[model samples]
Target: MTARYDEIGVGYALGRRTDPRWLEPVVSALGAAASVLDVGSGTGSYEPPARDVVAVEPSAEMIRQRSPEAAPVVRAVAEALPFASGTFDAALAVLTVHHWPDWRAGLTELRRVASRQVVLAYDTALHNDFWFVREYVPEVAALEDSRPSAPEIADFLGASSVRPLPVPWDFTDGVFPAYWRRPEAYLDPAVRRSCSALAQTAPEAVSRGIDRLRADLESGRWQREHAELLELPEWDAGFRLIVA
Candidate 1:
């Protein structure tokens, strides 16, 4: 688990940043909190701005890419946070739980360290709904277990709200699901490198999928099959926010 990020996360921050739309819900979940713990904080993408945030990460490569302005980060993993119990007002783990060696232990650690928790995760129910997952890179979808959802997250952390977060057609965060309307983005090797789905998948499989996607796009078949998506401004692609 520790080695996965260092290997796949070398350039994670280049295209992945906090979408401004995500900040409002995160701040709302924080609810007047002054301090926060950013667990599995990769390149400080969603670590809240202008707040006292202490980040815990295990990968030296990921740590190296962290912005100069990000919160002071500790070289550690989520399962064993170094902070004392109740050390902060809130804790956040955004799109990161799936990578943990022991997710349950990590969630319990979050509960122990903070009074409130804000987590962003994807619902497995809609995993196959993505065109890339359904058609191009089925191997990428095979990597996800049947666990990452709002209710499951709420159950783990005892959260109060587990609601969906929409993905803008031109979503700026560049998370895997954010490219629902912009399928061509997947063609760029640099763009795909930012998402673990592409970075971690079997190279042969990735090559096969990219060829299929490129063929579909060049043939105009991709646009014909998913024409409605172009008009929609934002879409619900199984992304959700859990707040407790």
Candidate 2:
């Protein structure tokens, strides 16, 4: 997690800013927890404003980009958290579980530190089916094959509930599938750089896909084929929130 993020985490805050929409769900899931442990909290994007939150991130590059006003952070990995058991009311891992080298151990640490665990993850099958990935960068599917599946994570966590999380059309956070409707956003270098999926994918494959997408857009082929997406308010790119 540290090494990979350290290389690709440069200017991470530019494209991965917090979307106001996410706060409501995250805060609600946190419930009445007074103190929260945010594991792998990148740039402190979605930390609840009202909670006493402590962020843990391994990458100095990611930590360096955190706002001065953001919660106090510890340079640490999820598998070996430094705190004692039950140190917080809840543990939160947002779009971060797959990054951990040993996710089972990381989750064990989450359970050790907090009474409740809340994780944001995605369904690999659904994510791979996204038009951009299905039609363009098929390499992403292969890349994700090694990552832990949402069900696998849920089973390990003994999740109480798992629900679908749809990506809003104009999502503020520039996650991999944030621009499902606004396809032009993916063409931007900065946008692609912010997403770990594109950053980690084979550069040649990404370039090929981007070139094809550009040509399709110019020739009106993309608009003609995915016209239905333009009218939707949100899309299900296989995102899910798990609570245990």
Candidate 3:
């Protein structure tokens, strides 16, 4: 996974900043835990600031991008966390499980290392409905199809609670679906550089899709079609939180 992230996740930190709104649920999921093990901690985006955290990620490039204020990060993959049993009060893997080559093993390690675990996941529902995939890049649907379902991830982690997390219309983070209300952002190569979906996709496909998207926006077709979405403060873009 680090190999892939290193290749496609270049300049990841520049655009993928933490959105404070996302912290509400992530921090809530931590509950009373004072210490956390952040597995697959890409750029330390959602790691709680108030808690003692030890981050583990596979990509050194991502580790290099972490803010000086971030937790001490270990260069390692989630498949094998270098911690003793019940080492931390909680663990977090946000928007990252899908990248693990051995997801079940990674979840097992997460459970072994912490009493509580939280995972943010994506699934097929939003893969088809998010206007981007439906309108521009249908190949992304194939990628989404290959990813583990939220329920599957929950079952693996022994999570009894799973809930939807909405994407704010003007979310600061540059995660794929976060730009649902701002379609023009996807056309910017620098913006796309931060999105694994666009970054890892075939350049020809991405260029063609962006061109069509540009055309639609120039003709006012995009706004005419998605006028109601403009009025929405938030929309469910298939992001799910699972707590165990």
Residue lDDT tens for model 1, 139-210: 877776544556677787777888789998878888888888989898998888888877878989989999
Q: Estimate each model's TM-score.
A: 0.95, 0.98, 0.96
Q: Which residue pairs show backbone clashes in model 3?
A: none
Best by TM-score: 2
Candidate 1 lDDT at 180 equals 88
RMSD of each: 1.5, 1.1, 1.3
Deviation (Å) of 57 in candidate 1:
1.0
Pairwise lDDT winner, candidates 1 and 3: 3
Question: How well is each residue in 62-126 modelled by candidate 3, as lDDT tens digits?
Answer: 88788898999988988889899999999999999988888899899999999999898876567
Per model, how many backbone clashes are there? 0, 0, 0
Which residue pairs show backbone clashes in model 1? none
- Candidate 2 per-residue lDDT over residues 1-244, each given as its tens digit: 4357999998899999888777678878887999999999989998988899999999999999999999999999999999999999999999999999999999999999999999999888888888999999999998788788788899999999997878899999999999988888889999999999999999999999999999999999999999999999999888888999
Which one wins on lDDT? 2
In candidate 1 the C-alpha lDDT for residue 201 amounts to: 81
After superposition, the stretches of candidate 1 with alpha carbons farther than 4 Å from their true spots are: none
